[model samples]
Target: MSYELQALIGPAELVAVAAAEVPAARPRLLAQGLALIPATPEFLAAFRVGDEATAAPAAAVSPSGTAASAGFDWFPGGLERRLAAWSKAGPIACVEADYFGGTGTQRAAVWADGRLDLGPITSAELEPFPPEGSPISRALRRLGARVTEGDDAVRDEFDAVGLGAHRATVSWVSAG
Candidate 1:
């Protein structure tokens, strides 16, 4: 009985699991979050989004139980709210020298029965382009940032590069 978790990365990309077959939502959501972080900025920002936009958006997992688009922006405001919701929660506090769109804000989402949701992401919208050669990564590369992927279990070292800096590693545990 596993459910998919769709995490919003940057403004455009959505690291989503379209009905992955996991045993529980917590590990699956957390794993999906780490797995979905765009290794590069272009991946960070891909696809277009419309805030206040509405449609029957599926929560990342497709009807066929597969990752719906390498990312899912299937609904309107679908992408923006995801990012905004997480930011607003304050549980996922993010403070960085550089962030996408030059700034960020936060709010809250409702969760129940082992499912979590946040949205109508406060003015949260997609970046409108792919995150290729983004300002943040390009700078980090110049500073010789030792980047790697996997090992998402270690919170403090799996952060992504955005805005003007790399995340100072994260240590997160789901309340679920």
Candidate 2:
């Protein structure tokens, strides 16, 4: 199987703010009480502020106000400034992962309290995992996703948060 995702994870209120900026944001609830808004093609088209595909995706707001927006391009200009503004209310994590044919790459960055907190971390195939773990894992931790410690069957932050339920970003749109 192969998996690829690009997303922003953060407080539900903040994520909702991000979503509202877009024209047709669809928010969905996932396991672990997290909310997700996949960056479907339609969503991306509606979200663009100008030419050059400046917008990323919509957002999902959890009951607890923890949310995520998937299928984003982090390198676009002004995204960081927007995320920083949203982080004033809470922390936000930008996460990306691509895995296929036994090789993969992951990247993540976090904004909190109006500034960049952790990463723009990147890890790729054949490289050792970072001491803190993969980029997504680290970003999830910053977003309050927890792991089961001292257990025979250990689950990392990503698994604990149930992000694996969808193998692809597009799957999230039709997911129940």
TM-scores, in order shown?
Answer: 0.21, 0.76
**Per-model RMSD to reference:** 15.4, 7.3
* Best of the candidates, lDDT: 2
Candidate 2 vs. true structure, TM-score: 0.76
Worst 10 residues of 1 by lDDT: 18-27
For model 2, residues 26-127, the per-residue Cα lDDT tens digits are 665644445556656666554345744344332322112122232234344345556778788888887778899768888787889887788767786878
lDDT of each: 0.27, 0.67
lDDT of 1 by residue, 23-82 (tens): 121221222222223212222233222322233444432243222221233322333334
Against the true structure, whose TM-score is highest? 2
The collision pairs in model 2 are 12-65, 12-66
After superposition on all CA atoms, how large is the RMSD of candidate 2? 7.3
